[model samples]
Every structure is written in structure tokens, then in C-alpha cells.
Target: MSLLNEYRIRLAQEQDLRAALEMKLQAWREAYSSFRDEGFFAHHESQLDQQLAWWERGLAGGAQFWIAETGDGKIVGLAGGTPTIEEDQDTGVDIELGVLYVLKEYYGTGLAAHLMDTVLSRRDALLWVLEGNARAINFYTKHGFVPDGTSEELVGSWAGLREQRMVRKHG
Candidate 1:
């Protein structure tokens, strides 16, 4: 069967936390190595505790996470958003798109766009793309996200890797 044919997208549960973290760590290591310092790949190992904490927080809070998995149960991509209220009275009810990724092999299959559309369809949301990641910036801009003047990324022990925030509005 074709690789795309066996892929599935579904809401992630607590049971999927470990695998999901592994997927994130692996993908990040591979993708961000260039944008980040060279030593990150050697030191940044996937942490089980971090994954457990994330699962706990999502279950306790109203956060939801989605994962795209293969028929054999391998996590290929993940996208998550959370309920947040911004200070601005103009835009009430906000959801932040926290994560979106696909394995290298599926990079050109339109998975990221599909995931963003799926998430954004639920509400007017905000997300950020790394400044150096041209591909992601292009994808977000093409989908109608605009610059919101926010750029504070949580770079883990790496320099020059930060976030540039963007938002999408429906008139």
C-alpha cells in the first residue's frame, strides 16, 4: 500500500504521549539542527517526564492534541492548540497552534497545510513560525496568517532559533 494511504489523523490521548515525544524529539533534532547550535542534537534526548507532564496538563486543562499516525501506529505529524484569552478586547477567544510537524519523507504531501486548516476551521487562531524556517513562514502566509509583532521563541540551549508569531482572522 502507498505510504499516504495508510496514514491516519486523530486526537492524541495519554497513551500516545511517549511515542509522540519521541517523534517530536527526532523530528526536531533533524529539522532544527541547522537553525540551532550544532551541540543540541547530542545533548537533547527525548524526556519521558516531559511527555508525561504534557499529557497530564492537557488532560487536566481543556487542551487538545492531534497526531497523524500511520496504520502501523507511527506518529508522523502532530498539531495542538490551547484555549487562551488575549489582553486585547477586540479579539476575544483565542487558540494558539502549538505544534505542527511531519516526518521528512512526508514533507511535500501537504500534511502541514491540511492540519492547519483542520485546526483553524474550529476558530480564529494564532500561531508562530520560526523566522529562519522559510518553508513554514511561506505556508502560514499563504494560508492568510499575518504578522502580529510577537516573536519570543523558547529556544532550548540554542541561539538564533526563535519564534515569530502570526495570526489569522476571518472577516
Candidate 2:
């Protein structure tokens, strides 16, 4: 069977946490290594256990998280969002697309779009993307998202990177 045909998207379960974490780490390394300082990843690596715990806790709390898994049950992509009331008040957006990531090897395979479509489901939502990530910006744009002229410099250990907000209206 084709690789695309072998994968399925479903709501993430507790057992999928480790694979989701691994996919997040891998996607970051592949997508951000060129522009992000080593310290950024170092911080993320140091927080792996904490992130895992957070994932478990969030899952237990009934948060929305989904994963694309292969026939062998290996997760290759993940997407998640949460309800937000104040962040996009001016635009009337109620959901925040917190994350949408796919393994590097899965790029150009329609998996990211699939994950995004599944999460947003044509709802009005907002998300922030690192300013220089052209690939992500393009992907979001292709999916009907447009920049709303909002930008913010990241703080803490990732102080130098800038993030831009993008919004996809209900259609």
C-alpha cells in the first residue's frame, strides 16, 4: 500500500504521548535548527520530562490532541488546539491552533494539511508561527490563513526569534 494510504488520523490517546513528543522534538530539530539558536533546543531538550508530564496531564484533562499514525502504529504527525476567549477578541476567533507538526520525512505528503484540516475543521482560529519559517507560513497561507500584522519577539531562552500571528476565518 502507498505510504499515505497506510496512515490514519485519530484523537490522541495516553499511549500516544511518547510518540507525539518524539515527533515534536524531531520536527523542531528539522524545522528550526537553521534559524533557532542552539540554546532554544537545549531548553526544549531539558524540558522533555516536563513536557511529557504536561502532555499526560492535558490528555487526562480532556484537551484536544490528535495524531497521524502509520499502519504499524507509529505516530508521524500531531496537531492540537485549545479554546481561547481573549486573545483574538477583535477578530472573534475562539480557537488557538497551538501546534501542528509532522515528521520531516513526511513533508510534502499532505499529512500536515490533513492534520490541520482535522483540527480546525473550517473554524475561525488563530495561531502564531515563527516569523522566518517560510515553509510553515506558506503552508498556513495555502490553507486560507492570512497574517493580521501582529508580531512579537519571543522572550526567555528564545529571546531573538520573532513570531507572527495568522488567522483563518470561518468559511
lDDT of 1 by residue, 1-171 (tens): 455666888888878878887787778866786676555654556355765796778766767778889878999888877665464223443677778887777776877776666666747778767888887788788877887877775655655567777787776
**How far is 161's C-alpha from truth in model 1 (Å)?**
3.2
Residue lDDT tens for model 2, 1-171: 555676999999888798789889888999999987787787898898899999999988889798999988888999999886575677678888999999988898899988988998889889999998999999999988999998899998668889999988866
Give TM-scores for every candidate, taking all chains together and pairing residue i with residue i. 0.83, 0.93
Top TM-score hit = 2
Q: In model 1, how large is the Cα lDDT of residue 38? A: 51
